[model samples]
Target chain A: MAKTLTIAPVSRLEGHAKVTINLDDAGNVADTFVNIVELRGFEKFCQGRPVEEMPRIVTSICGVCPWSHHLASAKAADGVFGVTPTPTGRKLRELCNSVAYTEEHILHFFFLAGADFVLGPGADYKTRNVIGVAAAVPEIGKKVVHNRHLGARILNIVSGKSIHPVTAVPGGFSKPLTDHERDMALKMASEILEFAKFSIAWAKESVFPKYLDAVKTVGVIKTGYMGTVRPDGTMDLYDGKIRLMKPDGSFVDFDDTKYADYISEKVLPWSYLKFPYAKSWNEGFDMDLDHPKGVYRTNTLARLNVCDKLSTPMAQKEFEAFRQAFGRPCHLTLLYHWARLVELLYNAEYAVQLLKDPEITGRETRVAVKPRAGRGVGHVEAPRGTLIHDYETDDKGLVTNANLIVGTTHNNAPINMAVKQAAKLLIKGGKYDEALLNTVEMAIRAYDPCFSCATHNLDGRLAVRIDIHRPDGAVETMAN
Target chain B: MTERSPIGLAVTSVHRDPAEERPEPEDFLDKEVLVIGCGNVMIGDDGLGPAFIKHLEARGGAPAHVGLLDAGTGVRTVLFGMVLAEKRPKRIVIVDAVDMGRAPGEVFEIDLAEVPPLKADDFSMHQLPTSNLLRELRDQCGVEVRVVAVQVAWLPDELRGGLSDSVAASLERARELVERLY
Candidate 1:
């Protein structure tokens, strides 16, 4: 008789999720599902609100990636009003995006997933967390805290608020970067750049080599990729054309305004999140490990794979090394961690470069705009993945319709596929331990997914519980 | 500057340079008391936290030694900083609306040790591990942590703004209770 094993509320990686694996009579894995709660009513809530309010209103969607939403919504509002931001305004927005990416990437790499690498996956559960990482590597721990704090400080200076920022507006930045503020932010960005450099180096020298075996096998999948890049095919997180690469390394770039033509969302009955696939490929949606159709991934690995080169010098060098070793379109899911470090270096370098530009401190950051009936689509490379915000407004400047495809939503199909792959690979004949189960979670962590943003709701309760369903229908539940 | 205590506890030294530790422009530790409201304004009664902060500001805010912050859904980041900071406020008071099977609009105080496990998988800080972070601050860092909770009248399943009538009315009472903490 077949039995079902459930890992509810998979620890870490943001938001709630559960893995349900079915075992055949032989105790071999048969099927798997990753169920995530759905967030409803955000679009309905945005209806009737002023288009100008979206940048601020959308920040409340998820505390984790508010900056992403804030900027995306602001860009959408700019589209609705049909006004481009001043050059300085655009630079300031990009600067914030870079800084925010640095902070988020650091947090995800060091604190969230760091526990796994810093303290071996088999380490005791109680000691396998941020605190554990701090305890073990006290010096690195201090640096992590200090740098993350620096990120907040820089944002606070550049914008009035760091968490729920209101600086980016429909026309441009609400606040101008003064010379003094710019100096302060520049100093901090330099510090973050140093840390980013140290981070990638440390990982390359110490962390990655130790996990070489795991990196090559765990959660490995052959899927297409998605990310944002400049006209020259250089990675650009703030603004660029969207590129969708096929599994075979071939790709096409499209305008953000035309995303609907290339991509479409599929509703799955088991999960609240929607699976987004390449509609333009016309391959249809399938998560089969051997041959997936229209299934592509976003976030770090995708961004690295989709971009032809990194805009910054140091990052470009690292990018070349990565591609030389892995080749175009690396399919190893765990490479997301390595790719994240590369992007971190690029963002840090980009932030410093932006600050050095004299125009970044200019006075004219925003332009005047009149409300008009229009539709706008804005896209950004959020740390999690490619984030797209679509909005429609009336002549009165009120939002009539709103649609958001967060970075995590795009990876929904990929995450499920990865989880299934890991389960099938590891749990043969139903043999699994806590460490093995956590390895399954490592697959999800590679995506650095934010279910909170994907679902757009918060209930403030998360606990990990696993239920084992026997052939007789009896259930045994376990929690951490 | 550092020492190991428990697995999940924060270890920070008390005496440190304010300039070296504070995150600039906002010296939360300079205040004797820190009061933060945590919730999402777009989520019905969940908006109580920000709503209460606005109410407190309308009433001229807290005293000079008290710091009032509307953390929204980003309370975890703030609390995490405090835990790792070399210097921290003597006391922290978190105000939010929760459903604990009590009467709507009921104002109550919860001891830090009693915070239930209600959050998980929040990348930055949503709610569950916030309690854990608070506990670490109190037990590991020696900061007094208190929770002021309001029983939400109704929490919508979907996004909706504004507090319910009862929750709105209780803000003043919650404000009074929080001010007394300072």
Candidate 2:
């Protein structure tokens, strides 16, 4: 007899998702499925709209990481017009990206996944939230709130509005930073840098040490990795060549626009999100733990594994330490949290370095764009993962076709594999509790999965609902 | 003699630089009442809150001391900042659309205590965990909070913009209720 065990609305992820595990007559884990509800027909609606408005229009796709879509769309629109942003324009955009990264990483570490490591996974549900974290760790809570607020403030100053930015235009940024604005940004960046330093140290000293056992055992999988790197293979979040590294530590690099040549989307009947695999691998997609094919990951740990070095000095040091400790191509899923902290530090240092550059305030922020028919593809290392935006324009510059592969969508296959691994490792003999299920969720949150941008909705509902089905096809049990 | 001041309303976007040393913009910190339109205008009836705010601004008869903001979907950012800054308005009113199994286009006020617990903890900052934030603001921070909710007519499953006719029609009624509350 085959039984189906379901975990719907995987809690703490950005949007709704479900994980279904199959069991054989012996009640052992056989297979797993992750179903994410995707926003319907967004690209179809984008057709016929003027390509220039894409930055503004795409913000509504996901309220969580609107900046990612806004910037990526703007970059695509820039490619369409064949105009490069002025140096100042590019710096401002990168600055915002860094600030946004700090804000997001802090939120995830402290409020979302923080509860798991800070208070332990078995803590009562009521005390395992942002409010509870604050109560338990008031000192760190205060610092986290203040620094996160500072990040938001920096974004507000640079982009006019942080949530749905309209500053990035077709050719370049819309506004140039004044000397005063630059000075203010530097002050904020300095404070943010302090917090970023404090964060990584705090994680290493307190959080990561406690989770070492879990890191070694939970959701460990060997797969290829992907991220953006410069010519020298330094990590970049804004613009760079795409690098897809195999599990064996060998890799290939290609131009950003040539992603289609290397990647392909595979659709499953139960999931709304598409599974993107490395087409260049020549192997078909499979999530088999021992003999996986065409499976790779994106996001923090993946970026760390794929890049040769981080551009900033402090972050580079941290990366080296991480490498020496874990070895390259680290398979531990829980180490994603540690990798995220390293990136946070890199973003802060990078922002400060950019702000100090005198050219960041130059007047030539934008280049005039003349529209014509062409195709453009833009990619960015969004905090979640690699986000790509592809657009086509007609003779009049109206969008003819649009396609977006957000960060979470790229990890669809890997998430399913991780969830399956965790379930098999923990739920022996089909006996499990809420804490056991949460350990499975920890596997998903390690990716800091942001489905709000990958899919779409606004109902304030929790992700991760569970339903256990017996071999007889009857629903057996349900839990939060 | 006629009044010297012109009859007009001022509308402002919420994005601001914290470094600017500007005064309290006519008691923004101590206002007796603050009205916020909280919804994503891109969806159908969810635009009611912002629509009602627009209607009120066009009508222009609320008390001079009261401040109105189109917080849109980023209401959490504003509310969270206020919590940290300790500069909350005395009374906060949130206008939004909800489907409570009520008639379409119907406008009503929900007691803060009666508001149900939000479905899950918020995973994104674009939306605050509203029920929790509201309670925190009222109970912990000692501020008065109220909700002005309109029953939504439709929210498309796809990326469609603008409000439906029935929901748009309720704008006037919502404005009237806002005026009475002020």
Candidate 3:
């Protein structure tokens, strides 16, 4: 007999998710599924619209990561129009991406996941939130809040609005960076760089060390990894070739447009989100912890694992130490936090470097782009993972077809695998408590998957309900 | 090097050639009162916030002291900016839609004390956890927060834009209530 235990509306990480774990006759873990609600035909509705509108329209796809969608769609449109942005245009876009990443990563590390590490996983539910984090670690909390604000301000200066940005257009950015704006941006970038320095040092000294034991034991799995990198194998977030790396640190690089040939989506019966697997592996999709196939992770750890080196000096040093401590292709699930900090430092340094470039303040930011019929693919390493936007346009420049594989979508299978792995280790013989449940969630949190972006259509009514179904298929209890 | 302003301290506003170019970060911070309409214009009935704000703006606009923002599900970021800003609005009036089993188009106020606990904690305009930001503004930052919610005729099943007739009809009244708040 198999009993089912369901945890609905998994909390805190953006959007909604439900975890269903099955228990065998002896109360041992049997299987698990993470059900996500799919967005209501956003890509379908995108068809027939003027392709130029994509960069603007896609911003609404997810309020949380609009900058990623905006820039990715703009680049795809650039591909469709067969035009390259001027040096300033490309640099501005990259700068915005870096700033946005800094904001998102800080938000996640301090406010969202911070509650777990700062306050302890077993802390009272009421006090285990952003406000709680602020109350407990007031100084760090202020730093997080202030730095995030600075990131937002930088974005506002670069783009028009920090949330639904309109600055990135098909050919390039709409506005030119004036001398005054350049000076302001560089100053902010330098300050952010300092904070980035402090953040990585703080995390290493105070946070990662305490979690080493949990990192080794919780939700650890061996899977392939994916990220974007320059031709020289340096980590890149804005634009680069896609690298698909195996568990052993070996990888293959492919053009961004060839993603369809390497990846295929698997539709599971219970979940609305599709499981993206590496079709290139020739090993069909499977989520078995012991013998998973075609499964891979994206986001921070994946980017760190797939890249040969970091571009910035400080981040390169940090990366070296990380590799020294944990061999290449680190299997520790919790190391994502450590990897995220390193990337944060890189973005900070990279942003300052870009701003300091003479060409970054050039008056010509865009090239004239004519509407043409063509297929185009664009990708960016969104703070979460690799985000790909593919589009086909008609001779009249109307969008004939549109497809988006957001960063979170690529990790759908891996997230479920990680969840199951953690549940098996923590929920032994169906013994579980709130604290233990949170520890299990910590595994999912490490990946920082955005269910909202993965499956954009949520009904807005999210309440966490736990349902325990007995072996006889009768629900023994339901708690909300 | 340009002087980098300290956290939670007022910074000098950047001057621009076009006087009416989109407001800068300083403008967002300097508002004495903010009336932000929070909702998704893509879902039926959920577009109440934008609809109400639009009606109000069309009716001879708010005073300079009152910054009327069409947040459009991006309230979280706006509120986050405000939370970290050196200056903040003394009052923030949020117009939104809620389905609490009330009559269609029925408008009501959700008291600060009535906000449910932060489950997801991530705040948004069209989502439940949005109340967390309002609470934070009220309790932590000392910004007076008020939510005016219209009983929605169920949000559309698909991504159909525009408001339901009932929700649309109630926009005027909702606008009036919000105007009174400011």
Candidate 4:
């Protein structure tokens, strides 16, 4: 086929995405792009509400990892309120955060990523997902389900609800946990440790090393990475100073107060979602497509790049080992999901320790919140990556405006460019098999974009779009 | 001493936030009657559950002694509330304002069997809550739970000002049902 093949609005995941494979006249590959098709005006929605209610309002953004946004928005609100929680408050926030990471990351790895590897890339797309894995490896499949259920249950215990929680508010939790709740959660999380360990090896040994040579040449976009920097200078998921590092692994001071300084976002004519790039350009496509310049990456890969250690022993060891092979800073996106598992493992381990600690039962249950009207910013790392809730408001606490940079926002440019790159690679075949398509799907998943979490509202007009360029002219195609 | 915990007389009539914003689980710990008012009280009728919780809270004079939990908007907290009960109750009266095509504030104490598990869950901090959790416990531990809800005039989002006079009057019926349940 002389024309580019496009499948817009990829089905079944979340939100909108269209996959396009560019083809030349001789039917050779040109480029591939998986265009994201949603925009979150959550930032605007958050403006003007009494800053006190910001946490609750923003927590509704994503059902998968509410704690991330809840904490991020709360911290931002804390910034506006000029109030930071006592150390205990920070710990509680971290506890809430750890539970979220364990649940969300586990689900993504096993349910989302498991299909491609266990089911085999060549398997039928329909049968190559969770269902296929369940049929092929019943025990491991059951274990994943069992562990996932336990993780969800733990979230239920800690925050009251598993999916979209409201437990970790601005000042502190509204209720104190009893010893029984703590004991039960600790026991359940401990059981999940074995399952999580099994999953990481499944990635590192079974998946990563096997596919290493293949993916090493793929997803080679080099851009600056961004994530929250801890006080200890390690990667922090719940709360920390924001760190923007160069592609060469050189790090600068981490600062949350000056977020607008290092990072930036751009909207492509092809995708509704905004692409976040480095304010300073290092390499890749001209970020300003019209003029094209900057290229920076954020989220999990960025977190991994910016961190030297994982807080948990097992994950930290794996981190050091992976870092050794991939070099000081890893550029491959295939390693992205694997890094997520590493984070998930540590989160599980940390959750067990925190729940086992007796002091948790006696932790101060609430923070006396004095909402003397001001703006606030909340920052927490979501499962996919770092999330920010920036709000500006008047003293009446009525929000003037709200801007949210979600897990996927940070990868907007790279994700789209990846699709284009892959399309350019696979454009030759007029007829494509499921395996090739799955590879295309995996390319998008590398970024782990949560489209549903980003797009708010029921405007059903959604599609995945790709632009195909021939030597003579360019054409656009779409699907829903 | 009694067959079931008499939760009604021990209730405090405090209206819960319609959004169920509390971080705690449902008053599942209470295990008797949970008066969940699904409205923002500052705006008016959403104050239904908290108003009742305050009444119940006042009854025992303290929250710890009186299991009158203000579930706020947290539906998931329902389990923790039920589990908190040493011995589950026979009937659980939930006083949330429902627009069931009835007179505003006309409180109805429908038996658990009669409420047909409309299964429409509270979107608070809970997921697949109420009936599902109750079933899990009953299947695992054999605890039977019930609910009592009142009909309101305005919609949940439409309850802008306060409870309609009719819904406000329903509080009396809810308060009365609490008296009878205990």
lDDT winner among the candidates?
1
Q: Please list the C-alpha lDDT of all candidates, in the order they appear.
A: 0.83, 0.78, 0.79, 0.61
Off by over 4 Å in 2: A1-6, A22-25, A38-41, A456-480, B1-34, B50-71, B75-90, B112-131, B179-182
Per-residue error for A438 in candidate 4, Å, reads: 1.7
Which parts of model 4 are misplaced by more than 4 Å?
Answer: A38-40, A280-293, A429-431, A456-480, B1-182
DockQ of 3: 0.15
Using DockQ as the measure, name the better of candidate 3 and candidate 4: 3
> Evaluated on chain B only, what are the TM-scores of all the candidate structures, in order?
0.80, 0.76, 0.78, 0.58
Where does candidate 3 clash, by residue pair? A39-A457
Top-scoring candidate (TM-score): 1
lDDT of 4 by residue, A1-480 (tens): 366666644533444566767777777666556665554445544544566566665554444455777778778766766765655456656777887677667656765666766666687655664445667877766676567657667776766765445665556564455666776777888888877788888777776766775477555666667777677777778877877777678877546656666666665455556667666444434543224346657767778888766777888888887788777678887778878888878888888777776656655644555545566767777876778777776655566767777877777677766655554454444657666666767777777676745653223444355555656665645444
Off by over 4 Å in 1: A38-40, A456-480, B1-24, B119-131
Which of the two candidates, 1 or 4, achieves a greater TM-score against the reference?
1
Error of 1 at A362 (Å): 0.3
Residue range A1-480, candidate 2, lDDT tens digits: 656766655666676677777775577776666766534437766788888888888876556677788889999998887878878788888999889888888878877789899988898876676667888998888888888778877877777677668888887887667667778778989999999999999899988888899999999999999999999999999999999999999999999789999999886555566789999999989888888899999999999999999999999999999999999899899999999999999999998998899987777777777767888888899989999999999876788888889999888888888988998998877677879888988898899897755652333233333445466766554433
What's the TM-score of candidate 3 when only chain A is evaluated? Answer: 0.95
DockQ by candidate, in order: 0.16, 0.15, 0.15, 0.05
Candidate 4 or 1, higher DockQ? 1
